[model samples]
Target chain A: MDGYKGFLGLLVSSLLVGFLSVIFTLIWVLHYREGLGWDGTALEFNWHPVLMVTGFVFIQGIAIIVYRLPWTWKCSKLLMKSIHAGLHTVAAILVIIALVSVFDFHNALSIPNMYSLHSWVGLTVVILYILQLLLGIFIFLLPWAPLSLRAFVMPMHVYSGLLIFGTVIAAVLMGVTEKLFFALSGYSKFPPEGVFTNTLGLLIVVYGALIFWIVTRPQWQRPKEPNSVLLQPNGGAQEGAGGLTVNFSNVDTPDSKLNHEASAKKRNFTADEVGQRSTM
Target chain B: MDGYKGFLGLLVSSLLVGFLSVIFTLIWVLHYREGLGWDGTALEFNWHPVLMVTGFVFIQGIAIIVYRLPWTWKCSKLLMKSIHAGLHTVAAILVIIALVSVFDFHNALSIPNMYSLHSWVGLTVVILYILQLLLGIFIFLLPWAPLSLRAFVMPMHVYSGLLIFGTVIAAVLMGVTEKLFFALSGYSKFPPEGVFTNTLGLLIVVYGALIFWIVTRPQWQRPKEPNSVLLQPNGGAQEGAGGLTVNFSNVDTPDSKLNHEASAKKRNFTADEVGQRSTM
Candidate 1:
């Protein structure tokens, strides 16, 4: 458990900063800007920041690290994966609403949409996110994929998930810069509102950095599934006939000794648990 | 070399897009804005983007992956480490120059400094980059640290390196947004300048993403040093007396099976080559 030494501390810090970021965003929009509203006004645009921080950045951060929560290791991986996907699903819906708010606000003010760098990167993050969500469900949630295929896609899925998260933070930082300049006339002079929002932006970045730090630590990863159903090399064709195909790519590195041991002891694992076999 | 497949293609793509981003930044500054210069002019501000993209983003990207270059695998690791550190040093110098240019321009126009979100984040990246460089040299480059200490710092070093890179991209994206809005008269209307700059911003994101993707792939990492000098566990206190203490953090993950193999065979490996031993 040497690896897990700082895990809890980092996890707590991540949660602290993550929620604090959301709270700050809410404070920025509600206190500094007009309070949130649904009407096609500038207030509607405020929803974009609030929703994005809550659902897109903060919730997405939680989803990325949820599997690493040692307390949750007792739960079935299928349940964990479901929760992961569910969080993502919620985030996607919030993002969509946020986007709708932006477009509505733009139309209300006759401001052109998709014209700034923030919009360009923000839109890309959105598209990539939804694609990642759908792909995660299809390959990981469904039991139809072959074990090998699932294994192969797992690395890319994990990498893209983290990358997308990083991009989300980047896009939000850009969005913040845009909003500050557009909303605050004395931004250059660092008025109270400007300083508060600037601090908020810094908090967002710190939140992201903390999440990235916590998730990438090798020692903090979930232990390998105790009872995975590994497929036989000769039984390739029957992989997806009705059995589980868990993605091992995320749970263990390609060079893990535990991975080799699992492969050697493949026959011992139950077919039903194959979908849960990950790092040890 | 199943892992090495597509590595070259990806490396080439990273380099191509990385340079293309710099070129586009240059075009945006020189072709769209005034040409670069010194002597406290707005044109001097152009160096801020140009130098940052070239050195901070592009060269830093190259530095991060230099160890992963298979062709360099044949070279002595000490040489490779030096080259890696050397590239980072070059990048640090360029970033410093970029900062100077921005400050000079701001001072000339009597503009206050470090007020904007971009400046806050950019300065943080700068400070962190310098700290990382210095720490890497102290713990990695110098032949003084104990193996255990080196191992402990390696994960953090790698994680911070990537996080800083991501932050750099985020900071740059914000810089792009700020510059476009300030410089372009009709950014909202999608003028030619606005379109080109926005594309430039997107290209920068693509470059950073490619670098992230390439560096994170397990297959693409450099092979372990053929003859590393390992240390005895009991001989830890004498580690930095005169021999090397190469960092394995960046080269191999903690979960690597080969690491266990190496540990079991620790007595057989020459201590001189321990600094070089990485992944197979």
Candidate 2:
């Protein structure tokens, strides 16, 4: 919102790229990994990667970038929070289904689970992801935590969200590779399935890189509102953060003995004037 | 340098993670991919993953983080640039060798080159990487380009370096998976070699995530010098990026009809004073 030049273009491109990756992953899962069928056998394993990519990677990217969209800047903060948390909620459910499919498939085949590094890292990331969502809601969305604690955890929430996103993408890469190796380990001189799977993996990587780059570009951060300054820890809000910030902390209702003649231009003042202002 | 509280810990941890990944990768290549003896055959292909990870992934990571190390900040900027570029040069050579081995093995076996998505993406990343290095040197280290152009491209150069680094990591993941799938397609459900290769892949992913996270953290950026602000695209340097900026654009070199008593703290100026400044 703070003038991320071409933000719309970038967001659309990110969504398109993410969609392409999901499609490629689905193709690999359905056509190559296992045919699309719910016979309650190994065919159920096909749901794992497809759902993981769809819910975890593609939808997850959307949830992260939702705030950066310029159109959402003026919407109420709570509304945006609901939309954000809602998307993540759905994504988490899909991830659950994805995980269940893998587990059920493993049990059906009498194969072991969590034995591969992919399983170890994948489960770790998903758990961390769930914790992140819960904590994000507690700190930023819900009013239970004090503003000070929310301020303190906000930076980490942002950082860890990105970190987990990257980790999940990496886990997906490893999972596909493991599957490929497991499925077609003895093909002579690179088979056709190898090309398809490698391409799908490549798309996932590209999709991830694009979304990370778009999300992290410093200039793209949503501009903070003047009232939002109160959200900053210690009240030392960013003044240079584009847009003329007006501090209304000292202003009070006229009935509260407020000076009616105070100059509007001199908005910023020390904390001495705090209680003069009326509560919202 | 401006108080990334646990920077030292993060840096140390990053290096350790990267080291572990490289060692594991080397183990996989040596023990499983191909034996030590080249024998003028497929054994040469062993060098591909080992050399790629060593040069492109591991050493390249070190090269990227060199700028982030606060201990080196006060050293001559030119020295840092040389070290950064020099490390990248070595990495590029190793990657060339890695590529050569793959091509040699492919040709020896009458297998095609650039046939898979891995080849396409891998080759593209390398080409972009080579161009990025050359462009970085020409625009930054050398004084050939005008300062305006240099400033304009500086942000992009930084961004693209990280992007290509990520793309290459993705390519490596795909390559290893394809190789695993190709080489071990018929193993009995999760073989030992698959475990080794999969674990190595996981390490690489973790290492990439750590390094990327470390490099991108804004607060962790190496603090700029007083004169560094002059490096801005419009030749207008930032005052104290935190606060307390001063403007002294009008101050002449002392005795040249200059006001000798100009306030030292008043060095930060507004936009009106921009064009009066000289360029490199």
Candidate 3:
């Protein structure tokens, strides 16, 4: 399969920026704010940013890009799906803890919870992330699921995953903005703390944009494995009615469903479409 | 010629939420804060949100999706491109004024400017937006340009347009959060103003998500015109090297270049490839 030019360079930049965001958040909380702890105090509140950057932004980004990694290309589809789901599960767990830390800090200080736009959007992302993970496991990882249903659900799955990732990035930015206003008194004066945190926010945005660019590129998408056993309705010979199970799930977004439409009819590729395929 | 199912419904919802976002920003500035002005008061700062919502979020979103509208399908591709660039031009002008308002407000108040993360991201978006606009005009809207160059630049043009739109929405949300914390007293108590502003933020997010969804759907993409004059290298038969200008820009993100590759080679579509085309 033809791979994207500069794929490695972009992927490396994405990870480099992603790790920088996590490290910056860690330093912001540890050195500028207070060190993290489990107590129901501001120290515990520090855990929120740390966990969020680690889980939601960094780990979740990795999960989204894992399928596109060239090293993973040779792995079984089922194995790749496990790594994807497992990373997401870890991210969800950390995000859940991060939420609890915020709520606990609010309760301890008698500050209200879920009052800010950041909270509203953050909660929505968390809920959607969880639902996406659950549905993904049930439909994609489960052995007994029908191929047609997977094909039907694949595009929505990819789209929603990207949406959730984007929403999370937006919410994190909102939270960063809100925090600077509340915590930094001389923030408007461009204090060192303010400048450093602003850089962190920029890094996060750049990292996210890079991830989106990498994921949405037609060339970088995970290629369809027509011979994968899991793509069959029941592993071996129990193909779906009308041989719909023969339509392999492309796993690429925006056009996956379209390809599904083509393959569901069991059509063979022509030279023109082969050129189109290379474009993808 | 098949159009997307429920395209109209989604388009309507996108506009509705987008307009609601603008309306909510208006109310927040007018009723909650002081009325708009140009005297470099906080009232003058009010134009920041108003112009941002009207131009960047609402109109900019419409510009991004204008091609996807069904009624506009009858319009020539050149005309549609004009409307697209024209709308973006309007958006850029308003955004410039909005930037002036903020800088003037800050200078008048003896407060520093471009200190906050919001400002950093907002300024980056504005700069990139202007660059995208200029390049778009030169590459896409102008006559006598080579069709090959247009095809080469179209994907980056669309990708950057969407990226700028998303970044603008994120910056706006960050600004909204910063404003709430700065202006509203006891905001954590969830005052009526805070709640209203929160709803506005959610509306903006929903509107952005809807626009992204509508724009990215393969079925809703602008159909390629195989015989359009504008697609010719120099119009009336001065075709480019290797007859490359025969490749029509699909005007669709993520896959347009793929279709271009398919067409540039001048291969006929077989039945299998035609099915794949429907997927696109």
Candidate 4:
């Protein structure tokens, strides 16, 4: 077996590297280019990359992988869910600010908005991110949805979460490269700052690959507790109850224990859920 | 159960879209920019993106998901292994050509190589891709290695395969965006070409998401035949008979039946494989 300490050590180091890489990108932008602000100027556009990468890339990554950290297991699943949702909420707010900065700066300069591929893809991902977050809260946290609907949405939510994380990284990479190429068009990239910015971009890619590795590897997935509520409380209430959770065994994230208990008790499902579970 | 027809239909459609996206990218470059060539000019650099996207992104994606196609289930393992390895080999060749074109064009024009983030990440991916391909063939296809060694490396091989696929897409996205921004400098993105290229990129992202969803989802993984040769031929010969295919459950791709029979008979290992399977 792999050493527990080794896994934890890697996790800590990667987390530090991931966070620091985001910070380093921001620092490079502030140090070499323009300092971050929302003063409705070209300098305001600098906050666009820094804040977006910080929130959409680094902070969101932490939120997604929070369950995998050992210290999180000590908390109740409800607390962890709150923490997950809370972190994502902060990320969402930061991204909104980032978007506003970009749009405002563009508008102030009479520049066209939503024109570049980076802008197009970046805007689409931000929309998807907001939708994913909203749907996550609606289905997972709020009591507006029933239990079986939550089960059906959970896998898609997880997939979208990871997909969005990846797309955000792509946007970051694309956006940064766009800025560099546009700004440094006269030169052939022999400048030291060009190399420095390229290094920053590489760090972003490394951070992204690291996050994907930590989150997606099967062995590194959060292990199921064997007696999670789905198996126990729903056994008598629903037919073929375990089918809905076959994918859960793979993801095995400890979400919300309160929701799990409340949702597990209502195991009855309509034809739609049956169809969903069949495809599960 | 999910309809076999429905799953097959989605797979076929997505594959077509994925393939066409690669073609669309190629056509866009050929039509709008310089047509494909290797005369050590700026036009030669055009071939880099088209060839890389078609081969590394599209064809490599096909290779990764080939086993998931139900028609491959009847093949006796070894044929599929050959097909998988052969496809990857072709992809490696294409990527090499793409890289050479870039480097060659850069050299002729007195431009620097590996200066951009896309080139840095792209070159690293190519190196890793070649290494992954070699290691895979060595542990999996070549007769030099024992089955226990293959089993030990299976999980990492699978993870690396998926990781490389994701990275290739990231590199493609980065490379494409860099080209667009650099080329479109001094002009705002208010043109038909920009729209067309953006659509091309969005297609790549969609195609990638579909491939990942198909290959990584649990229910959609290629199912292993329960009575594959690893269990039968090595029953009496090896101490731990199933040591050869412990992680075969994960990568249930059909490979060479001959190797399965021949190598399955000898499961010799010096204790490392013993510890490996415990985690497996």
Best by lDDT: 1
Q: Clash number for model 1?
A: 17
TM-score of 4: 0.83
Model 3 chain B poorest 10 in a row by lDDT: B238-247
Candidate 4 C-alpha lDDT tens digits along B106-213: 999888787787887888889999999999887676655544455556656765777688778878888878787767553475777777777888888888888766
lDDT of 1 by residue, B193-263 (tens): 88898898888888888887766643344544443324322222111110001122333222335566557
Badly placed stretches (over 4 Å) of model 3 are A1-5, A226-280, B1-5, B228-280
Q: Flag the better candidate by lDDT, 1 or 3.
A: 1
Question: How good is the docking of model 3, by CAPRI class?
Answer: acceptable
* DockQ score, prediction 2: 0.17
lDDT of every predicted structure (CA atoms): 0.73, 0.63, 0.71, 0.65
CA RMSD for every model? 7.9, 8.2, 8.1, 7.1
lDDT of 1: 0.73
Docking band of candidate 2: incorrect
lDDT of 1 by residue, A1-280 (tens): 4335577888888899889989988888888889899899989999999999999999999888787787887887677888899999999999999999999999988889999999988999999999999998887776665455555466568768887999999999999999988878989998988999889899999889887766654334455555443432222211111100112223222233555655765664322212234432
The C-alpha TM-scores of every prediction are 0.85, 0.77, 0.84, 0.83
Q: Model 2, range B227-275, lDDT digits (tens) per residue? A: 3323222323211111101111111121221222122212532221121
Ranking by lDDT: 1, 3, 4, 2
**What lDDT does candidate 4 reach at residue A216?**
44
Error of 2 at A131 (Å): 2.1
Lowest summed lDDT window (length 10), candidate 3 chain A: A238-247
Worst 10 residues of 4 chain B by lDDT: B237-246
What is candidate 3's lDDT per residue for A1-280, written digit by digit as tens? Answer: 2334478889989999999999999999988898889999989999999999899999999898887786676776668778999999999999999999999999998888998999999999999999999998887776654445554466467668877888898899999999999989989777888999999999999998888766654444455444321222112111011000011123322223445544552333221111111111
- Candidate 3 structure quality by residue, lDDT tens digits, B42-108: 9999999999999999999999888777677677767877898899999999999999999999999
